[model samples]
Target: MTSKSGRRVLVADDDEAVRRVVHRHLEDAGYRVESVPSGVEALARLRGAERPDALVTDLQMPGLDGLALLMEAKRLDPALPAIVITAHGSVETAVDAMRKGAYDYVEKPFHKDVLLLTIERALLHRMVLEENLRLTEALAREFSLGNLVGGCAAMQEVFRLAGRAAPTEAPILLLGESGTGKELLARALHYNSARAGKPFVTVNVAAIPESLVESELFGVVKGAFTGAVASRTGLFQQADGGTLFLDEIGEMRIDLQAKLLRTLESGDFRPVGSEREEHADVRIIAATNRDLGTAVEDGAFRRDLYHRIAVVVLRIPPLRDRIEDLPLLLRHFLGKLGAAGLEISSDAMKHLADWHWPGNVRELENELRRAILLRGSTGSIQPGDLSPEIQAGRPPRGRGDGRLDLRAIEIPDEGLNLSDLEREVISKALQKTGGNQTRAAALVGITRQTLIYRMEKHGLK
Candidate 1:
């Protein structure tokens, strides 16, 4: 089985038999378990270069107790899940553990199955909660730039930029093609930045009309224009201390660009009819699917404002450039959809991964969702289940086959061939590593189920 922790666990229990039992059980469960006698040694392991995903410790250890370890663990990483095992009548210590964020505790004589299940569930729950917190923290990461989606060296650079840009107050300029996720990156930048708590205001410059743009942006004073009966504020004022994203800046009217520049420069604006100036503290981020340099040369954009907003410029690659990410994205999306009870077939997935998605990720997701519904079963989704449009966009042959295809990646020909591969790989890797999917995936440079699918594929009993 694959380790839910994906890392080692530190077990601090003085009982020799109990220690051996835990070490063997967790090791069988695919965790690299390190058992130690005292809380002091466990704390030493944690504070040193070696870190555990979770800690299972017994209360009332000599000198340094489990309660002290819990405090230190919380200080190190608050989300680190801990399971406290205690002797009976230690109700006070158990209650204290919960109050200080020890996830939950089990009695000293806890069953082996109970301990393993508790550890697995606690770790998985912690992972989900951390992911949510990260999502909330990363609202400003400009996901468009990082959309390439691979752990490849080239892809790491893109992710690095996204991480750095997520927390800044500076305006981020995303330059990319129409299908390259410029807007997604813009949203990431907002969610991960200082203004993440505030609203992210977006305006498509190309979508608005030149005549009504001024009134739309600055709002109208009472009797400011033909339809102006009352006063109102605009999007810029509404986005104070937050982010205002202007997409397709090249298409903005030059006159309107001047007013926008004024607001960016001095944070001051006046209603269409009002002579008084109102101040707005808004951070401006801009995106364009076109060449802004060419637009600037042609006098379609002001050079000064371009420098102000382009303080952080990120160029996103097209889907064709980072096609290696297709498989990982495939696994992530398929796993997610499967959890939601939609089983996508390998052939259908092959068609998807091999296709030239001109519409990029958005198109791939739509097709997969449609395939799920069309199949109308929790069983596998096959090539026949896909829309004709997806089948038509297939990439060149051998695109989906990697170097380790035989062991980690499955090929869907027809009939029951796909599951055959899955079963074969899972069975062999389990046998070879004694049922450890995590190490097998590492050996193959792919995921655990990828190996499992091959085990089932080849029927390697």
Candidate 2:
């Protein structure tokens, strides 16, 4: 018998002998027991400032019966765990009491051990419920919109759009570079929405093999395929009444994109090899790193599907564009990585700011982790603690006068075309780098894919 020393139990019965017997049993089992002869008096004690942890009441009370008392008690504290005591012939009433919100029912002439065990189980159930609630609240706070760290104008705009759109049922498309926090934003939206208590399922489209993508999203009936052995629930069904975050949506196969589009439009999808169609009320939040408009133009992505998921598009800017947020992000990551006490030297901070983070925030966090490990016994991180690429930094793009060193180019009286200027800069970068797209992209401070897109747009060789 586990000693429930401080646990308080309230016992109510119309019979004086029953109350005394129950009180003595509960007290002997190490519980602080309070006995009342009527449900009315028990209700009064429940309504008082100090409430017991569990309730035990007899079903046939005078004015307020056990069933009524149980309902009222649950109404006052929705999570209150109540157990009802009933006579041997009142098994049906005990069942009714359970339906009215009693945790369990104990028939008359029950052994003391039986009563104590039921109380123990009821308290355990209440403990589990409280723990789950605490965890849910903590997750809500962690993913709250206000908790996302960003102070730059670009991030502020992103936050503003997310705040306004989070409460809506419209489909959302997140566009950004690979390392931008698109998935984090998606979670924040889901956790803040009306369906916060429901599931939030995520699927990385690019990660799954092409052969399994369809079945993974829409599920499979048992024996639907050669080796599906058991019936499987898909991401869409699992996220019913909640959210489905499709990561790397651009990488989804064209055939599967059509299926995804159909599901989004109709909210009905047939599991692979299944004759019947299943309906799931799920909100879609898709994310991608590719330039979808270009993909649609190139006939790679379906235009109809693009429009469906892009009802509300939010673009997360790359780290380079929001350099001012570096300090805030550094502190945020350090605290998250459990190195909150570690400090960064001015030289190290300068290197971090200067480096063009192709991998964005994800890379920055990884770099911080590495630096923390290399910081050794030193309380502060120095420039040498950073990666070599970051230590080398980028060649100065600005002059001592705090202006871009574009003095080599002169604007003629007629003025030059900006497009021509852009083309020339890109072409020169490619020519200077021996047509190596990666190096050329680095010289131009753009992603290799972006450089290729521009080169194709300019009809560059």
Candidate 3:
């Protein structure tokens, strides 16, 4: 739908003079323009399919007040960018309008470029958001429901919920502890969705800077900022026909939370510096390690945004909780690591089966790779070749002093789940050493290859 040209512009102001001024200014700036006197007229025009890329409306109008009109326009298409005109220092109203879904606000009597700049940024922002979702859905892995990895009953339930929820168009939120593979669940949802072939964009909301997160997600035109030397697209636009994964979304700043809520509702946004609206067909998949409910109660996160993004909540359990599949996981990792063709010593194997791994699958992989690396040119791994920490009967992890890394487990005298216990040990040991399988193996007095083998055996990852 993109052509080598400018974007659509909608002007809604009762002041004929102001409308004419804005219309001419935007047209001269290389945009197609349509002007209406009031919000009601703007809505009628939009409903008629004369959708504009952006709308510039005055706060006060004869009918369908600007705020109400803006809300209605968004209801028509959240992607339709808009800017509100307000009196100077009336930022409180502008902020309220933003909370109500306006793209941005411009004080009355501002320079033409100021208004133009706001619209440009808004349009570009929408473009990037769509693009981000486009990439995410298009590039998502083919993760079937059965391929969710764990066989534990808890995981099985998770898989079931994920599969059941995949086909729907509603937003999905995945909640879990750190390192619990929330992103994987999100990818699974996208890949299994109807828009699987489109883009699938991921934005670690916590990772992006507060100052730049908007432009980075929405898109930015040339000179949108001090360092923006050229035009750039945001994640939203890139994910136009796909899914957008907002990871660690709970970490986003409070100010940006309102903007996100509007976009989630409207599905459109502008770039960093443009007076145009960018459209996209996007789905959202948000994941977080923090408890959003708590954050909302604490006033750290917006309530509206939470409800918008959490239509379908999937909880990812920690590795320790599902230890029954340790063996399966260990074998999977071992095969992937190419650690086959090596004989395992019963002594080493037992040691691995008994140790605690804290790093989860990632940690297990580290330990296994380290062990394999120790195999040298001969590719023959031996327990004696293990790292000194492991050889000294310490966890593969580095020690600063007295960190309670792995707590040795006491196999119950009456009864205990052997498979589960072994996986827990493997997970803890790995976590202690930060997933250094080789060192972990050595500390447990086994070869790194043996650790991998054990991780595989236990499905510990």
Q: Each model's RMSD to truth, in Å?
A: 24.3, 7.3, 15.9
Ranking by lDDT: 2, 3, 1
Model 3 Cα lDDT, one tens digit per residue, 1-461:
23315688888899898889888888887789889898888889889855777788888888688889888988988877789988787889888999988989988787888977887898887787678766654455446565667888888888898889999999999987656778878878888889787777899875666789899788999987899999998899999888999988876767778877877788778888888978767899998766677667656678888898888898877665666666666666667787766544555444444444455566556766777777555445555555455455556445422234456746577888877876787888899889876457545543343466678777876
**Distance (Å) between predicted and true CA of 157, model 1?**
2.3
Worst 10 contiguous positions by lDDT, candidate 1 = 397-406
Looking at model 2, which ten-residue stretch has the lowest summed lDDT? Answer: 394-403
Off by over 4 Å in 2: 1-3, 15-25, 58-60, 85-101, 106-117, 167-170, 237-242, 254-282, 294-308, 341-343, 376-380, 394-461
Error of 2 at 375 (Å): 4.0
Instruction: Compute each candidate's TM-score over C-alphas.
Output: 0.52, 0.74, 0.53
| Cα lDDT tens digits for candidate 1, 193-255 | 767767778888657766667776777788987777888888888888888888877666667
- Which candidate model has the greater lDDT, 2 or 3? 2
In candidate 1 the C-alpha lDDT for residue 173 amounts to: 87
The reply for model 3, stretches above 4 Å from the true place, is 1-142, 340-356, 376-461
- Model 2: per-residue Cα lDDT at residue 440: 82
Among these predictions, the greatest TM-score belongs to 2
